[model samples]
Target: MTVATARAHPNIALVKYWGKADAASNLPATGSLSMTLDIFPTTTTVRIVDRDLDRVVFNGAEREGTVRDRVVRFLDHVRLLAGREDRAEVITENTVPSAAGLASSASGFAALAQAASTAYGLALDDRSLSRLARRGSGSAARSVIPRFAVWHAGSDEQSFAEPVQAPPIEMVIATVDAREKAVSSRDAMQRTAMTSPFYPAWVTSTAQTLESALEACRSGDLERLGRITETNALRMHAAIQGSDPSIRYLTPRSWAIFDAVAQLRGEGVLAWATADAGPNVCVISPPEHTAAVAERIGALADVVIARPGPGVRLQETDA
Candidate 1:
């Protein structure tokens, strides 16, 4: 059979989900809100193969070890859903900086889910696709939709993501360090969940922020939305930092960008910084300030301005 191809863009969480209630199921402890970026994406192709095991290639290199094993396991999901235990040949290309708090895995798994399901002849709706993607990577659930999407914490059937009806916002992503994080997001999340004394506090605070964020989005109040995004991300990182032995993803450069954001704010630019489990910072701002935000952030590190991107797209499929 010919390959099925899909493309999906990475997402930056505004209302972040830093811990999981069910790690095995990739179920979050709380819902997350995110904005899909048009700048970086993962393009994946999946084809049922004749081999006994799955064959996986990433970025033109054939992956091995734990990475290959994980990819094959993710492919097994599609096999089970199709009721055909066929191994697949999977190829993925990630444009986003790997493990740099850019949500590369979100795009990777979302593309895989869309391509693999179609290749296996399973016609899945957006909700079903989002649920399936979350099995591989929790944040992937939000990447299934473009603009703004919220991934709810619920049972497998009920926890899928739906898009927010709001104006698309631009984000200036500054790469403080393009190198992959020493600690993976999965490992860091689990450790923080186990050791952080403030985990519960964050969950409670995030619930309120989620509501306010949604309202801000609906009202086209970019300042409030930016504030919510920045504060929510800081709350998530605080929980991580308070863990035993701690995990600090932010660097001096990351904080420098934060200073730049504050400066930009005082200058009447509404840029606000948010980060995930890495040193990179994403500054949410109105489109008019995007170039200025990027220029200001560019002083500290590489910067890219991204607009709202499209959801996962099945580009090609063959029976």
Candidate 2:
């Protein structure tokens, strides 16, 4: 028997990944930039067992359904890579809420990929491990990279995440609604891609936006970076709203938070707001203003202040 455990941090995309280029390979339609957060990480342990079926426990509960299926499917791929037929027993503990657009899957799959590959005796490199993690969650690729990372949009073999240099910035995440979103990001992205007229524009403009954002990061221009992050996020949500049925993840509370950020900006505060595929909002600011931003947003909802975090790391291994 072999056992391994890994921990990974969830990332908030500054330049969002709202759609997939190739659904089968889970490739992003366009490149994205993100900062892996230090708070609310997920830890996963993988153990090879002789049983035919894999067992999965999440947050101390017996996990079944799509969540469990995703873990098992990832394990199956790991087994295939290692040329081992043994099933796995997966134990996951997440500080972030699952299916809530908080990038829970990003950290979850990153830890799984690391732990499962180690336990299966696959000495995969960082890029290979990122590619494998991408199979489980698209943003999981970025979580495999330390601190700020960029996920390149490319072929299955070419697409992966690499660390990027950025100035010191902090995030204030407001959990407006922590429950599972009404529509999954997968379903919502597909619908937006197929039906929204703005998708083409989004795809075309995202590449340019990413270039500008990267330049902002390189130059340590917090104002430029924050502007790009807030605008790009709003643009992605605009594409989603243009879908045939109109999928809306941002709620009134989310709007209120955005308004507060705008208000802070009007008052000479360097704060910018962004969100994933859910109702929660994240405000990015310099470390000096993180406390004030969090305190202001905290009045509206629960706030978690986060800084840039490290990549996935193995905690233990036994053979």
Candidate 3:
């Protein structure tokens, strides 16, 4: 096969997915909606050829272990679907920091899915591609689309692929800490799912949160969306507290910054914060208020603000 390339977006969850209903399938334990970011994403190139070697390179290094497993699984799925078993060479690069609690896995795996499917001449639709990506990482499923996308909770593959109708919405991500963390997303999710008693409550509340958030987005009510997201993140952390041996993602600095954002909201600044599996906080505000939010957030130590941006797309070398 000829060379093929694809770029996948990185998504930040408004309603978080903290566990898995089906670990092997990478099914979500809860429903979620995410906004894909423009600044950070993954770009991949895949070539299928009659080579004796199967190789994968990521960010100038040869990948191994779970990373290799994810690539192999994606390629194997592509081969199975397209009826080709040619040895493949894969190259991937990420604009986002890896393992820093950002959604690198979502972008990386989605890029792999897109590249592999393209290389193998597969005509898989978005839902089919999403299901394939989901097997690699749960959140990766939502990264397959642009703008705002939702992943529905269901019993089986067909049921789980159901899409939610939502309009495009703006999101701003603030990078508080970019260094890689000790815990991996997979490990964190499994630990919390097995140990957290509040996991049930997290799952039950997602539907309501997602419904309200979508409605808020549709009506251009940034305040409503921000409120739902902030509450959803708090609920996710509550599950972590319920875990045996209880873990928390919050740092002292994180709380300080969060409190600062809360203070701003109290001052009628229209600012709100949400977090993923890490200490970094993502804040949402209107385009007009984005600069104000960023300026306020930047006052806190070591915080950087990313402004409103588009979904993932191919990188133009000239631009």
Candidate 4:
């Protein structure tokens, strides 16, 4: 097959996904809903090659060790599905910060899944592609659907992510800290599942939040959606904090941004904040006040305003 390329945008969860029910399967313990952001996308291209092992290059640098191993392992899933034995040459460029809780892996793996499958002549539809992407990163499943998505916690066949009935909302991401976190999201999630005292409560709360988020999306209730996003994110972090060692991702700057958002909301600006696995804060607000919200949070951190974006899609090369 000829070369194939795909692009996917990072997403922030409204109903957070914290634990894995099955580590080996990468099955989320609870469902999640997320909004795809227009900024910070990962574009991936794949080409089948006559090589003994898969080669992965990220942002012009050849990856080695664990990163390369992980990419190859994920590629195996694509190869098996496409009935191809040939290795692949994979190159990815990510606008999102790596390991910074910005959902880079979500967009990265989603793009890779689409590009690799297309390169291998696999005709998997969006649902099947979402399932395949989840094997690499759980959040990637939601990234396969545009705008908003809800990932269900069923078996492989039933646990696919689909588009939710939510309209687009303006988003402002406060880049508080772009550096990689001390503990990766995967490690933190596993630890929380194993040792967090509030793990059960988090799971239950996330499920309820998912239902509410879906409804808010359908009804275009930005206020309710913003509230759910922040609450769900805080609860997810609480579970991490309740773990044995207690992983902390949010920093003082992150807190400041949250406080600013809260103050803005108090002023009736509709600003709300949610953090992922890093210190960076994502704000959900209306388009009209996005500039003001960004200006308010800009004092604490760099800001980027974005909106809902499209999902994983393959494109032909100019060659």
Candidate 5:
């Protein structure tokens, strides 16, 4: 028997990945750039055992249902890659709020990919490991890389994440609601792509936005980076709203936070807001302005200040 433990941090996308190119392969429809946050990491430990079915213990409870099914499927993929059929005992924990648009799945699957592959005796490099993580969650690919990372949109072989150079920044997370969202991002994205008239325009525009955002990162222009981040997030939500059923992730409180962020900028603060497929808003600001940003946003919602964080890493291994 073998066991391994790994940890990874959740990332907030600067240029969001809103849809899928291929559903079966779980390939993203657009490229994305993100900064792995220093807060709310997930740790997972995988232990190979002599059993027919994989079992999962999440946050100290034996999990069954969709969460357990997802973990088991991910482990099954790892087993296939390693050419092994042994079941595993998977124990995972997260500090991040799950299914609330805070990207808890990104860190969770990243840590799982690292621990399961190692415990299953698969000697994979970072890129291959990132590809493996993507099979669990597309954003997990970026979480496998440190600090600023970008996930490419292409064929399975070409679509993976890699580290990129960027100017230093901090994120102030305003948690308006930490509970699980009503609709999963996977379901929302698929509905948007298939039904929304704005979906095609979103895909094309995001590709262009990603390029400009990448240039902003390279040139050390935080203002340009922040502007692109806010615009891209708004555009993503617009596409979601255009869906036939009108998927709404951001609520009144979320927009209230955005309004406050805009007011801060009006007062000469370099602050900008971005949100994922959830109601919580993350305000990105320069290092010097992080304290003020956090303080102001804290008045409205619970706040967590974060900086760039490391990628997935093995904490322990035993055989």
Candidate 6:
């Protein structure tokens, strides 16, 4: 059988997804929007054959247990739709920094959904593939599209619809701490959902933030997007504080980078900081302001500034 492949790039949420309403369904506790990155993403290839073996390889290493199980679940879903249960060999490669809270799972699962469905000859649309990807991670649903994407917290089956339009916006993600985090997004959200007293408040506030951010995007107002995103991230962090046996993801360096951004803003640089469930910060600015943002960030610490780019799509081998 010929191998069918798909590639998906990861997205860093400007309005971060912190908690979950339904963990089993991977539904977010709140709706969120993200900017797909240019450099960091995952590529996956799947080949189906009439064999008894099911296999998966990640970056040349054979995987088993949870990772393998998740792939099988995705493939199984594809099989049901295609009306054939052919065994598949799955391979994935990540160009992003792993376990650094840079949305590795978002790109990873999105690629898998695209690759597996395509391999099985399922002519799934982006929305269909997004729903499949959401089964693996809530944020992954948004990574399936490029530019700006939103994950609406509606019904599990009806949620991952593609937007009719997206704004021209750009974000630069700065890796404050590119190391394995003590709390994974899954575990952190699970704990927050069950334990945090302010979880309800966070949800209500998230709706407001989502509306404001969407308006900002539509207006092509980067300043408005920046302010709303920064505020939303801070509120998400507050929810963590309200969690019992309180947990925090921000490192000193993370705050240092944040403070530097603030300082630059004070100096008239058009930049703002937003964070997810981890320490890394994503700075949002207009395309014209990206160089100024990068120079400002460079002074704070060693960081990479990615300009606004297209969403996840298949790469041409020769191009």
Model 5 over residues 200-269: C-alpha lDDT tens digits?
A: 9999999999999999999999999999999999999999999999989899989999999999999999
Looking at model 1, residue 227 earns an lDDT score of 83
3 versus 4: better TM-score goes to? 4
Listed per model in order, the count of residue pairs whose N, CA or C atoms clash below 3 Å is 0, 0, 0, 0, 0, 1
Model 3 C-alpha lDDT per residue in residues 248-276, reported as the tens digit of each score: 77787777777978998888877778888
Q: For model 2, how does the per-residue alpha-carbon lDDT over 1-319 read when each residue is reduced to its tens digit?
A: 3899999999999999988889978999899999999989899989988887999999999989998888888888898999989888999999998788899999999999999999999998999999999999999999999899999999998899999999889999999999999899999999999999999999999999999999999999989999999999999999999999999999999999999999999988889999999999999999999998998899999998999998999996555
- Candidate 2: where are CA atoms >4 Å away? 317-319
Model 3 TM? 0.90
Question: How do the residues 106-151 of candidate 6 rate in per-residue lDDT, one tens digit apiece?
Answer: 8898888877777778777888878888987787898888767888
Evaluate candidate 6 by giving its C-alpha RMSD to the native, one decimal.
2.3
- What are the per-residue Cα lDDT tens digits for candidate 4 across 153-206? 978788889988775578899998898889999989889889999999998888
What is the Cα-based lDDT of residue 187 in candidate 2? 94
Stretches of candidate 4 above 4 Å error? none
Flag regions of model 1 displaced more than 4 Å.
Answer: 317-319
Model 6 segments more than 4 A misplaced: 164-168, 315-319
Candidate 1 C-alpha lDDT tens digits along 79-147: 888888888899899899998889999999999999988888889999999999999999998899988
Model 3: residue 129 alpha-carbon error in angstroms: 2.0
Q: Alpha carbon lDDT of residue 236, candidate 1? A: 89
TM-score, one value per model:
0.97, 0.98, 0.90, 0.97, 0.98, 0.93
Error of 5 at 53 (Å): 1.0
Model 4 steric clash pairs: none
What value does the lDDT take at residue 76 in candidate 1?
Answer: 78
Cα misplacement distance, residue 144 of candidate 6 (Å): 1.2
